[model samples]
Target chain A: MPLDIPLIGARTALWLVAQIHLFLAAFVLGAPIFIVISEWLGLQTRDPRYERLARETMKVVAIAYSLTAVFGVLFAFVLMGPYQLLTNYLFRALYPVWALYGLFILLETVCMYLYWYTWGPLSATTVRKWMHIGIGVVLNVLGTIVMLLMNAVAGFMNTPPKAIETATLWELVNNAAWWPLNLHRFLGNITFGGFVVALFAAFMFLTSRTGEDRKFYDWMGYIGNLIGVGALMTMPLAGYVLAKELFLYDAQLATFMMADKLSGYFVMQGLLVVLLFLGANFYMWLSMQRIEGGPRFAPHMKAVFGVLLAGGVIWVVPQNFFPDLLSKAPPGVSEQALILPERFAFLGLMVAKALAVTAIIIMTFVTYLLYRRARATGRIVWGRIDPMAQYVLIFIPAVAVYLMGLMGAIRSLTRMDYHVYGALKDLTPYWYVVTLGHSSVMAAITTVSFFLLLVFVFWVGFVMGKAHE
Target chain B: MSDPGTDPREARIEAVPLTPGAKGGWRRVKGPGIFALAGLAAIWVLLPMVSDSWGIRFGAPYRVFFSLAVLGSALFFILLNWGPIPAPGSPLTTFASIFLVYGATVGGVMSFGLWYYPQFEIPKPAVEQARAQERGKQAFLSPAANCFACHSIEALGIRGGTRGPDLSAVGAQAEARKSGTPAEDYIRESIVNPAACLTPLPASGLAECLPAADPARTYPPLMPPGFKDRLSDEQINDLVTFLMGLKGLAEQDGKSR
Candidate 1:
C-alpha cells in the first residue's frame, strides 16, 4: 500500500466508480438475459405463462435499461471529475477501444429501447421471438464487449502485462484475464438476475389476493430461483479462476486473498464457499425425498454436506498458529518467505498430484451415481432446453469451470508483504495446505453441487407441476 | 411403472421458481416454506439501508449512484407490487416513474454543481484558466519552444514577429486569403506538440529553430508550456491542441532557415 493520498483516494474512487458502473452494467446485461430465458422457456414449451413472464420481465427491463443509460452518463461525468486522473491515465492508450465503447453503448441503448418498445407491437412468430432473443443476446454481447474493453484497461492497470507499450487497443482488449472475467461475470449476472427477479416474483406471489396472480408470480419465482441457483452453484469455479488470475497478476493481492493479515476477507471467502456448498448440499438432501425419481438420494447429500461443513470449519481455521511454536527457525527470518516453498511448490510433481486425481475421480463417481435416478426421468422438467439451445447454455457453465481452473494454475505471491511472515522464517505447512486444499475442495464441491443443483431444479419443476394427466 | 395421472406438484419441490406464470403456475407445489416475494422486497429495501451505518466515505459521485439504485429498486418493486403499495389506489409503475423524476431532478442539480463548484474553492476569476493559456502562449513565442529556432512570432509577443513567421500578420492573412483554408493554424500546433502533425517545416527550412532555454531546448521540440493540469476539459480539447497551428509561418520560417 505505498499509496500517495491522491493515488489511494483516486484508486478507491475508481473502484467505487467501477463498482457503480458494474452494478448498472450488470442490471443491463442481466435483465435481458432474464427476459430471454422466459421467452425460450415459453416458446419451447408453448407455455403462455412463460410468455407472460417474458412480457412482464421485459417491461421491468425497459425501465432498467433507460436507467442504465442515464446512470452511464452520470458515470461518464464522474470519470471526468474525481476519477479524472485514473481515467486520463487509461485513456492515453485506451482511446481506440473507448471509441468502440461509445459506439457500442449507443448501439445497445437503441436496441434495448427498440426491443422493449417493440415487444407489444411485435408479432410472436418463431422468427420474431427468435429475433427478440437475438436482440437480447446481441445486447449482451455488445454490452459485455464494451465492459470487457473497460475491464481490459482496469484489469491491465491492476495487472498490466509487459506488452502494454506495444499492445494495441485490440490486443489489450483481449487480455489474458479478460475472457475469463467475461465468462465468469456473464454467468454470475444471469444467475444474479434469476435470484433477484425471483425474489420480486415471489413477493408478487405472496401478496396477490387472486389465485391466478399468485400462481403466475409463483411460477416466475420458481424459474427465477432455478437460474439463480444454477448460476450460483457454478460461480465459484469462475471465482477460483479469477482468484488465480489475481495471484498471477499480483502475488501480493493473491496473498491478501489467501492468508495475509487481511485474512478476514479470505475467511469470508472461505466461509462463503463452505456456506454455499453446505446450502446446496442441504438443498440436494431436501430434494432427494421430494424429487420425482430419487428414492434414496437424501442422506448421501447430507454426507457430502457434512464433509463441506467440515471444510467450512477448516476454511475458518487460523493460518500458521500451530506450527510456529514447534519448528526451529530458518536464517534471516526477515527473508523467511524465501525459506518455505511457494504454495505451488507442494503441487509440483508429487503424491499430492496423484491424490488430487484420485479424489476427483471418486467425487465424480459419487455425484454421477447420486444424480442417475434424477436424470433417469427422461424429460427435463424445468430449466430444460432443446439440444441446440442446451449447447449454448452448456458453453456458459462449461467456460465457467474452465476459467475457474485457469485462475488457480499460476503462482504470483508477494507476501501480504508482511513483516510477520518474515518473522516466521517460513509459511507454516498448515497455512499452505489449507489455502490450496480449501480452494480445491471449494472447486470439487461447487462442481458436484452444480450438477446437483441442475438436477434439483428439474426435480422442483416436475414435482411442482399439477397433475398433467 | 409410474402413474401418468400423478400430481406433479406433489412430486418435485426442489426448484426456486423465478418466472411465476400465467398458467400451470405455482399453485400448490408439494413443498412448504416458500416465502412470499413482498417480504423479500422488504428485505431487499432493508438490507442496503445499513450502508450508511458502515462508516465509509461514499463521495458525491457514489451518493448520486446510490440514489439511482434506490430509484431503480423502487421501480422494480412497483412493477412487482412489493408487499403492498402504501396506497390501495397506486399504480404498479408509479414508484419507478418517480425515480425517473428523481434521476433527472438530482442529476440536473448535480450537473450544475459540477459546473460551478470549482469557482468557490479556487477563488480564481472564471477566465483565469483562459488567461493562463495566454500567459503560456506569451512564454511560448519568446524562447518557449524555438519556433524562432527556425520560425518567428512578432505578432505573437512583444518581440517583433520576424525571427519566426510574422504571427502578427497571421490574423490579417487568414482574412485576406479567405481561401477558407487553414495552413497557418496547423503550423503552431506542429511547433508545440510536434508529434501531432509531421507537417514538414516551412519553406525557410528553419526546422532547427528551437529555443535556448532548457525547457524549450533543441532536439526536443517544445512550443507551448505543458500546463496539462490548468486547462479545462473544453480548453485542452483538440481545437485548443490545434490553436498553435501557425500553418504558413513554419513553412515561411523554414525557407528563411
Candidate 2:
C-alpha cells in the first residue's frame, strides 16, 4: 500500500516505536530470567540477600513488564499503519505463529503477575518457594517462546526465504537468518537485562543513605555485573554466527554490513563490544582493591588490558578510511600524504577485526579468572568502593542501549528499499536508504530517549510504591 | 507519624485477604472490563473518524485494530495490577485475563478485516517493480555499475568485452549453476564476488562461459568486485532484481538450439 501520513512520516514513527518496544521487551525478557536464577540461588545457598534481591528485582519486572506490553501494542500499530501490505503478506504467511506468540504473551503476563504478587505467599515454606521458583521458570519459558516467535518474523523480513510468496509456514520461519538471530538475541537479552539491572543497582548505590544500603547495593551491583559480563563474553561468538549466516544468505547484504557503506556501523559495533568488555573488566579490577590479596592479580591486569586495547583499536578501524583517495585531497599536495601503503590498511579488513575481537574476548575471560582467583585467595575487604566504579556501571548500560539501538537500525536499514529482502519492495515516499551519519544520529537519539524514559519509569514506580507504603 | 515496629508493606498485605468473596471478584473484573470496553469503543468509533479527519492514508481499519490492541493490552495490565482484582491475585482470573487480551486482539484484527473486506484482494500486481527494475537496468549500463563495460548482454546487443563471461542468459545460468541458489542471489553474489562460483559452461553451449578456474590470475579482476562500495543498497537490490529477469533470453536460446 502507498503510505502518506500527514505529520510523522510512517518510517520515522515505526523506527521510534519499534526501538523503544524492543528495549522494553528486552528488559521484560531479561528480568524474569535473572529473578528466577536469583531465587533459585537463594534457595540453594539459604542467603537472605539473594532472596531480597530477587524480590526487589521482580518488583521492577512487574512494572517494566506492563510497559513492555504497552510498547509492544504500539509497535504492532506502527507496523500495520505505514507498512500494511507488507504486514499483510507476512501476517498471512505466519499468522499461526503470530497467534501462538499472542498466546505465550498472555501466559507470560499471567505468570509474571503471579510470580510478583505471590512472592511472599508462595514462598511461605521451602516446599512452596520451590513451587514459586517453578512458576518463575514457567514465566521465563513463556517469555522466551514469545521472543522466539517474534524473532522468526523479524528474521524472515531480513533474509526472506526464496519464493516466500509460496513458501510454507515452516519454511518461512526456518529462513537462513532465523536461528542465528534467535541464538544471538537469546543471549543478547540476558546481557541487556544484566546491564539494566546493574544500572538500577548503581543508581541505588549512589543514592543510598546508610551503610547497610550502600553494602547491599554494592553486592547487588556486583551480581548484576557478574551475570552481564558472563553473558557479554559469549556474545561475540553468536554475533559471528549471525554475520556468517548473513553472508551466506546474501553476499551483497553481508558486504553492505561489514565491508562497504554500512561498514562504519560494524566498526562502531566493534568499539562498543570492546567498551563493554573493558567496562566489565575494569569494574572487576577495581573490586579487587577491596580484597586483601587482590593486589597479586594487579600485574596481570596490565597484560590483559594491553591485549584488549590493541584488539579494540584493531577491531574499530574503519574498513574504508580513504573514501576519497585522490580527487577530494588538497588540489596540489596529496602525493606524499597518500603514499601510505595498502598493506598497512589490511588490518582494517574483516579477518583482522575478527581476530582482534577474538583476542579481546579471550583477555576478558582471563581478567574474570583473575577476579575469581582474588576472591578465592583473600577475604573481600568490603565497604567504600570508589565512586568511579558506580559511574562505570552507569556507562555500561548507556553504551549497551546505544549499541543495541545502532545495531537495530543497521539490521532494519540493511533491507534498504525492500520491505522484505529482495521482494515486496518498499514503494513508500520515504523508501530512500538512510545515510550512515543520519542513522547513527537517530540511533543516539533513540538511545538517550530510552534511558530518559527508563529513568522516568523507575521514578514513577518508586513514587507509587512509596505512596503505597 | 508511622509505627516503627510495623512494616507498612507487610501491614497492607495482611489487611487484604488472600481470597476475595464472589462480589469482590466481580468488582475486580468490572474495573478491567470497563477499561477494555472503553478502549474497544474508541477504536471502533473514533479511529475511522480520526483517519478521515487527519487524512491518514493506508489501512485505517488495520491501524485502528493495532491501536486498540496496544491500548487493550496496556489497560488490561494496569487494571490487573491496580483494580480490586483478587487479593494477592488469582490464577483463574489471570488465565481469564489472558484469554480476554487474546480475544480482544483477535477480534480487533478480524474486525478490521470485516470493516475493510473489499480492500483485501489477492495477487495485487507490483507495477512499480517493473519501473524499478528498468532503472536498475540503466544503472548496470551506467558508469556506476558499468556491467556492460566488460560483460556483454547479447540479448541487449552491446558486446564490448571478452574479459568477463557473457551475461546474455546469466539469469537462467545462475539458477542452474547451484541447485538451491536463487537466480537473484546468484546474480547478487556475482556482482559482489566476481570470481567465486563462476558460472560453468551450459552443457547445451547456448552462452559464453567462464573458464571454471582462475579468471583472477589471468586478468586484473576486471569485474570490479566492490559494487557495494559504489552503489547504494537499494541500487544493488535493483540491479539484482533486474538481473534475475535475464532468464527469458536463456530460455529462448535453449528453444532455438
Candidate 3:
C-alpha cells in the first residue's frame, strides 16, 4: 500500500497494459459477431442498408482489431517484466489455462479475419446468413471461454483453493472467486462497450449533415445509451452479489473493507449515493428530452433534485456527530467509544439501504414523467447535434482506469511470497518497490492520458461538427 | 364485386416478375467464401497441444499433433504470404522483438528457462573433493578412529567433552599444529611424528588412562591415529601447527572420569 514511485508506477503500468489489452481482446472477440449480426440481418430482411452498415462498421471495428494485438504483446511484456516471480508461480499453477487461452486466441483471430474477408464469398442468401451467425456464435463462445480462464487465475489469487494438501496444480487453477468475478467482469464489459458505442452514436448524430446520417446516428446513440445504462444497472447488482460472496468467503477482508472506525465515512458514502441518484435523474431527464420537452414534462425535477441534495447533505453529516452530541451530555458521564455498538452498525446499514431506495424512487419518477411528456407531445426533432452525450465517452473510461489503478494495490499489499494468505512475513526487502512503485507511475500516466483524450476529442469534435449543429 | 369475366385473383397478380436467377452473377463471386471459412475453423480445433510444461502429456497422440502443428504452422509462415493477414504478421514481428529482448534479459538476469536460467540446470558437485571434505569434517572423528585424548576434540568419549584440548577446531589452524615451542611451537615439537614428542600416557578411553611415568597414574594414552610415518616433514609441521592452535579447551577439567 505504501509503495514508492518506481514500483507503484511499474505495477500501475502493468495493470493498465493488462486492462487495455484485455479490453481490446474482448472487443476483438466480440466485434466479429457485431459484423456477422449486421450482415445476417441484411440478408434476412433483404435490405442493402443493413449490408452497407455492416461493411462500413466492419472497417471502423478493424482499427480496433489491429491495435488490440499491440496491447496484448505489451501486457505479456509488462507481466513478465516486473512481476516475474508472481507471473511464473501463477504460470506454473495455471499454465494449463493459459495454454488454452493462447489456443483460443489463435482460434478467435482466424475466425475473425475469415469472417471479415470472406464477406462476399458466401453466396446463397440462407447459407451466408447462417455462416454469419456461426461466426458471431463462435466469437462469443471463444471470448467467454478466454475470460473464464483468466477469471479462474484472478479468483485463485482472491480465494485460493486447497492446493497445499497434495499441492496439485488443478486446485490452484479452480479458484472460488472465478465465477463471481467472471460474471461481474462479463457484465461490466458489455456495459462499457454499450455506453461507449452509445456515446459515439450520439456524437455521430450530433455531427451529421445528411438526414439519413443524422437518423442513423440518433438511433445508434439511443442504442448506445440504453446499453450503457442497462449495463450500469446490472453493475450494481453484480457488485452486491460480489460483496455478498466476499463477505461469506472472507469476513476479515470484508470487515477491513468496511472499517469499524470509518462509520462516518460510511454515512458520507451513503449521502454521496443519494446525490449521485439526483444528478443521474437530472441527466436522464435531459437525455429523455430528445423525446420529451424535458423542462415542462419533468417540472418537479428541480425541486426533487434539491430535496435529494439536502438528504445527501444530511447523510454527509457524520453519523457519529449525533452520538457525539449525546455523549457530551452536560455531566460527569463516562465517555464510551464514539460508535454506539453492533445495533448502531446495523442502523447505519439500514440508513444506507434507505438512501438506495430513495435514489431509485427518484429515478423512476423522472423516467415516468419524461415518458409521459414525450407521448403527449409526439415531437420528433429531425436533427440536432447534442454534444453532452459525447462527454460520457471520455468520462467512463477514465473513471474505470482510475478505479482499476486503485484496486491493483490490493494484491501487492495482501499477497506475500509463496504463502498468499499466511501471516505477513516480517522481512520485506526494498526491492518490493519494483512492483509497488510502478502502480503509482501508471496512475499518473493514465491521468495525463485521460486529459489528452478529452482535450483532443473535444477539439476535433468542435472543429468538425459545425454543419450538423 | 365478382370479377368472373377477368379471373380476379390472377388479374391482381403481377403481369410479369423478374427471374430469381438475376443475382446469379454476383452470387458467383461470393460462393466459395463459405467453404474457405469452414476449412479455417476445422484447422483451429484439430491442432496438437504438447510442450515440456508440467502436465503437458508427452509421447502420446498429442505429441504427434504438436509436431504436426508446429511444423505445419512454421512451414505456412515461411512459404506463403497469407495475404499479409494481420494476426500471423503481428506475432512474427513480436517473436523477433521478444527474442531480441529475451537475449538482453538472459544476459542480465538469471531465470529458470532451460539453457537460459540457472535454476533449471545447476552443476553437481565433484565426487572426489566432496569425499575429501567429508573425511576432514566428520568421518575422521568417528569411533573407528581414536583421534581424541592427547589431541583433545569437542565431540569425544566421556571426558567432560575435554581432556588434552579440543582438536575439533584444529582444521582452521592446521599450520599452527606443527612442531614448535611455547603454544604453537610446543604443539609443533610434539606432533613431528607421534613418537617424536612422546608423552607418558596410555591409549585414551581406557580405564588406565593416565599421564606416563607415574605408576599409580592409571590413565589411558590420549594419542590419536599415528601420523608417525604417514606425514612428511612439512606436512607434520603443518599438522602440529594446526593442532597447537586448537587450544580453546586446554584449561577445561575432565568431569567424565
Candidate 4:
C-alpha cells in the first residue's frame, strides 16, 4: 500500500528527516576524532590552547549528540511508518545486525558522555588524561562499528550477494560494495567533521570582540580546514574504487549512473567539488597573506589557480546533452547530433575526467605545499586575516553538506526501481528514478534546513554553557 | 613568568594593525563587481556562438557557461580581496556570503533542467525478421539468458563483458568458421551447444576466452550452453535474429563475401 502524509508526501518527509539525522550523525561521529587528537596534542605539548579547543568543540558535540539521537529516532519512525515493507524486510533479514547496531549505539553514547563530563577531573593528572583519551578512543571505535553496521545494510541494498536466501551473515555483510562504502564514509565523516569545526570557528572569529579570542578562533579554523582538506584530498581515490566496484558488480547499473539517469547529478557534483577546491585554495592563499614571506609566491599561486579552474571545467564536460536515454531528441536533431562530436568525445571519457581530477588534486596539494613553505619561512599573524577568509571557511561546509545530500540520494537511487536491488523489487507507485531537477531541489532544501537546525544546536549549546557558568 | 600553556612563538610575533580603509571604501567593491559583470557578459555573448559552431545546442555548453561564470566570479573575488581592504566583519555580510554560495550551487543544478533528454521517433520495421531482432536484443540484455554478460557487440553500443568474443561481426564471420554450414545455422549451433566448433585463438592466445580443453589448443568454449532449456523457442529465434543483424562495418558497406 502506498502511504501518504498530508503536505509533503511520505518520501519527501522521510528524505528531510533522514538527511537531517545523517548530517548531525556525521558531525557527531566526525568531531570526536579531531577532539581526541586535540586532547592528545594538548597532553604532548602541554599547550592549554589545544585543550581549550578540544573542550569547546566537545561542548558543541555534546549538545549535537542529543539532537543526533532525536533525529535518528524520528528517522526510524518515518521509515517504519511509510516505508514499512522495506523496513520489515530489512529487519527480518538482518535482525541480529540491527540488534548489534543498537548495542553499539548505547555503548558509544555512554563513552561520549563520560569523555565529555570528566574533562576537568581527568586533566589534573597525566595518568588521568591518558585514561580520558582511552575513553575517546573507545568512543570512536564504537561509533565506527555503528556506522559500518549500517553501511552493510546500505551496501547490500545496492549490491546484494548471490543466493541471499542461503547466504551466511558474513557473506551478506561483506557484499561487493561493503568495504568501499565503509572506506568512503569513513573518510567522508572526518572531512565533514573537520569542515563543521571550521564552520564553528568561523562564526566565532567573525563575532569575537577580543583579539585573543579572535586569534584562537582563527587558529582553530585553520586546523579544522587542514584536517578537512587533507581527508578531501584522498576522497577521489576512494570514490574511484567505489565506482569501479559498482561497475564490476553490474555494468548496466553503472551505465545507468554515469551515462543515463544520474549523469546530470554527477555534473552538479562536479560543480560543488569545484567550489570546494576553489574555496579551500582561496582560503589557503588568504592565510598565506598573514605570513611575512607569503607575498613572494603570489604569481606561482595564481597560475596554479588557473590550472585548477581549467581542470574543473574539463571534469564537468558531458558526453551528450541528453539528460537520459529515455528522453527524445529535439526536432532537427539526430541521435548523433545530441552527442558531442567525435573530435571532442575524448574530453568526456572516463580517462579525460580522471586525468582532470588528478590534475586538480595535484594543484590543490601544490597550493598546500606553498602555504606550508611560506609558514615555515615567515611568522603567521593569526587573527589578522581578512573576514573574507572566514566566509570562505563557512562556504566549504555549506558546499560539503549539499554534496553529501546529493551523493546520498545517488547511492540510494542507484538501486533504480528496486528496494533491495535484484532480490526485492520496489513495486510501489512511486518506483522510478527521480528527475535530477527534483533531486537537486530536495538536496537544496535539506542542505538549507540542516544549516538552520545546526544554528539552533549551536545556540542551545551556548545557552546551556552560560547556565552552567 | 611565562605560562607553559601559551606557545612561546606567539609572544615574539608583532601585531600588524590592519589598514581597513587603505584601498579606499567603494573602490574595492567596484573593481571586482565590474570584473564579475564583464565575465558574465562575455559568457552570455560568446557561449552561444561557440556552441552553434560546434553543432551543439541547449546542453553541455550552457552548463559550461554556468560553471565558468561561477568560477570566474570566485576568482575575481579572491583577487580583489587578496589584501586587507575595508571589508568589515558583519553578520549581514556573513549571511550574504552564505546565501550567494548556496544560491549559485542551487542555480547551477537547476539550470540543467532547461532541457530534457531527447527521444527519437524512429519508424518501426515492417518485416517480421526485424521485429524478432528487436525482441532478441531485449532478451540478450535480460537476466534470464544474460548473453550480454559474456559477449559484446561494440557496433550496437552494447559494451558487454569481455569474457567472450566480440560478436560485432559474428553474423558474417560465422559463415566462414565452418566450411559448409550456413551463417544462421552456425550461430544457432554456437548458442545451443557452444563447444561444437571453437573459434581459433588470436595471436595473444585464448586468455580472454573460456579455458580451453587442451593447454595449447584453440579458443576455449566459454559460452554457456544451457540456453535451450532456459528460454522459450520463440525467444531463442528472436535472439538468433538479433545476433544475425550484428553485421560489422564491412558487411554494412556490402564488401562481405
Put down candidate 2 lDDT per residue, A171-227, tens digits, no spaces: 899998899999999888999998888877876665554566666677788888888
Task: Rank by lDDT, highest first.
Answer: 4, 2, 3, 1
* Interface C-alpha RMSD per candidate, 1 decimal: 22.4, 21.3, 27.9, 11.5
DockQ for each candidate? Answer: 0.02, 0.01, 0.01, 0.09
- In model 4, which runs have C-alpha deviations exceeding 4 angstroms? A332-337, A463-469, B1-17, B24-82, B85-257
lDDT (0 to 1) per candidate: 0.43, 0.67, 0.44, 0.78
Q: What would the per-residue lDDT of candidate 4 be over residues B1-257, giving only the tens digit for each residue? A: 12335533343354454666456556646755676666666656665566555553434445455546555655555454546644445767755665676566555544543333322222123234545776888899999999888888886678999767788878767767777778888788878888877765555443222323543556566777798999998998888888887778554322232
Q: Residue by residue across B30-83, what tens digits does model 3's lDDT show?
A: 323443344444434432243323322222222332333334333322211111
Candidate 3: regions farther than 4 A off: A1-9, A23-61, A119-127, A167-170, A202-211, A260-283, A292-295, A300-347, A350-358, A361-369, A372-379, A392-444, A447-469, B1-257
Whichever of 1 and 3 has more lDDT, that candidate is: 3
Q: Which residue window of length 10 is worst by lDDT in model 4 chain B?
A: B118-127
Task: List the candidate 1 regions with Cα displacement exceeding 4 Å.
Answer: A1-17, A245-263, A281-298, A315-318, A321-469, B1-257
Q: What does each candidate score in C-alpha RMSD?
A: 18.9, 22.4, 25.1, 14.6
Candidate 4 lDDT, tens digit per residue, A1-469?
2254656656788888999899999999999998998899888888777898899899989989998999899899988886777888789888889999999999999999999999999989999999999999999999999999999999999998867879988888899999999999999999999999998888777666578877788888988998999999888899888988999999988898898888887877877787788889999888876777777988888789879987987787677777777776767757765566656678789899999989999999999999878766776787778777787787898889989999999998899867888777653434567777677778888888888777676657753454587
Identify the superior model by TM-score, candidate 2 or candidate 4: 4
Candidate 1 lDDT over residue span B102-196, tens digit each:
23422332232233211111213322433444444444444423334544454323354343344533433443332333544443344334444
- lDDT of predicted model 2: 0.67
What TM-score would chain B receive for each of the candidates shown? 0.23, 0.44, 0.29, 0.45
